[model samples]
Target: MNRFALCYFLLCVSSAATAQDKEVQAIRTRYQETAKKVQLLEQDPQNAALYVHRISLNDKGTPWPAVGNYKKTIKFYFELGDEQVHTLVRIDITSESAAHQYATEYLFDAKGQLVFCYDRMPDGQSPENNIEVRYYFSGDKPIRRTEGKTISDKPSPEQQPQAKRLQSDAAELQSLFKAIDK
Candidate 1:
């Protein structure tokens, strides 16, 4: 309305764009440095699941580290509403931590565009502590937001992270899941 108000709005919009560009470039740089990761993305699709994760706390407002980012990956499988195959690949990140007491999950379409995002609770408070991401995309480009199903139960003791027991346990679980999913 007023000239001062309009100027303020424009500055805010410009600053936001700059911040987003920086974030994307930082991620791309990380990908470049890890050439092996890029190679895997080109080669083994399954193993490329490694890139499916990253860590980032939301600071879009307020100070840095006000939130906590637990896990992220560049590759994930999705089966929604009887889809024939995994419809979208994502670079997923979660911002949830004990200290901040906030959690957010985002799904970027394969082409690295935000398709849909679940901020805090999209529909309502989830029954569990974990956040669920549900989004749609056209090929690699994003289509729109979608309903998300979540795991209400807590992670099992075996699922808890352990320094030494992780590898063997993960391998064993992966085998079990393979058999069961089949």
Candidate 2:
């Protein structure tokens, strides 16, 4: 009777695990199906130029500490045989009080989709405070991962200032694209 009870317990445990696996697999399938329905965007040169123009304007409007306190550079790359353009922005800000460099790269697909982005910024006095994020997108949905750190819990709004800035930047970029599309 004891041996029979142990076997039954093992079987039940295995069955529960198998059921959970099936549920996870089902969810993954649904996610993939939804992602497939998200259409890839086409590349538009005129629109792309407009996007660059608008972002450049915003970057220019960033208040520097002084007239000679900052330097800004923008570079664009077009992929061969792919309808993709990549833009890299570098801003070096120096103040008598402090100095830091901020850089971000944006990748847009042929379909005017912002497919990937990497943003890097200085964290307080500690190099560890430096925040870097790389985001991958399928259409408008973002899959994001941060390098060099882990968080035990979800960050509160106050703890996510950089993310908020990036989100705002992405929104502006999207609006520029939409304006050109119209």
Candidate 3:
């Protein structure tokens, strides 16, 4: 390749990388802002328009007692407003036993899109060691994920399926909210 052509190609690639970096930064900023809003709402729950529902689940992820077992409990949090059923914002799932404890928090945007998920569970190597993972999404697409102190801008193969499941669970919970509102 000629020297001029090589230089032009490098410049183009550099510009593209810079633009992508800006986009990722924008996404991160937006996620942080939304997270702050969620925090404020949580702090003053009594003053916010909030709806909460709790359900018990067995080891198989089904409703408790149906399988004659009790495992975890999931709490759904919805922001009540004109949109009503379309305002699902957060979900907290917790499980505790003699052997281990696990918890996960799913956060959604105003449009009922899963935007962030925080999971805490035993690392499996030891009962005292727990791992925490934070997954961030732009709409239905995972953009960034973090495990403990390590962060990755690229989403992993499993994150896609996990994102879909979280979204599906949010939708199901929203449907339940709609039914209850009726």
Candidate 4:
């Protein structure tokens, strides 16, 4: 009778532990799915940017006018996978006649701790300003950061002054990214 009781107790304990492990695994799987979304976004910023922007596009392929007092807009995109989280935010500046787009990206670990981040202001064909920033982290702590900017270059005095400062800034950012990649 004593031996049977001991075996039963151990079996109960093992079953409880297995249940707990399954629960933990489920939570981790959900978290990982969320993080992967960000990695997918980074792999295709332009398409992702376009996808977000299309939420407000018109038939003519141009952005529609602001509806009311709201002239600026913000959007958040998230992805999780492999115990990592990626987040992207886009800020839009809208006026009566023009609009601008800015965005930020972030990454987090399985424990919901930030692991990396990247901020970007895409330099589209437009002659305008641009900016990019990146941060790398380890175990909820940032270990490195890189920032870059592109100021359009003003056209020569003999010609019309184009959005030169923004162009210049974009070029600078490109070189900066290249350096860091190496």
lDDT of every predicted structure (CA atoms)? 0.39, 0.47, 0.70, 0.42
How many pairs of residues collide in each model? 8, 6, 0, 27
TM-score, cand. 3 vs. native: 0.65
lDDT string for model 2 (1-182, tens) is: 99999999999989976764564354345334423322111244543322232224234445555543454554333322335443222111222213566677565555545555567777767633656765544455443434557521233455456555655676575555445434
- The C-alpha stretches of model 3 lying farther than 4 A from their native spots are 1-46, 57-70, 83-86, 158-182
Measured by lDDT, the strongest candidate is 3
182: Cα error in model 3, Å: 4.1
Q: Candidate 3 has which clashing residue pairs, if any? A: none
State every prediction's TM-score relative to the real structure. 0.25, 0.42, 0.65, 0.31
Pairs with steric clashes in candidate 2: 41-111, 42-110, 42-111, 43-110, 43-111, 123-129
lDDT of 1 by residue, 1-182 (tens): 69999999999989976765565455444434444554675688566633332223344433436433433222233322244323233333334332333333333344434333333432334425433333332233322333345321223344333212323332343344334433
**Could you give candidate 4's per-residue lDDT for residues 13-116 as a string of tens digits?**
88976764564355445445654544565687655421222123232345555632223332334332345423222222222224345554443344444444
How good is model 4 by TM-score? 0.31
Candidate 2 vs. true structure, TM-score: 0.42
User: Number of clashes in model 4?
Assistant: 27
Which whole-number lDDT from 0 to 100 does residue 138 have in model 1? 29
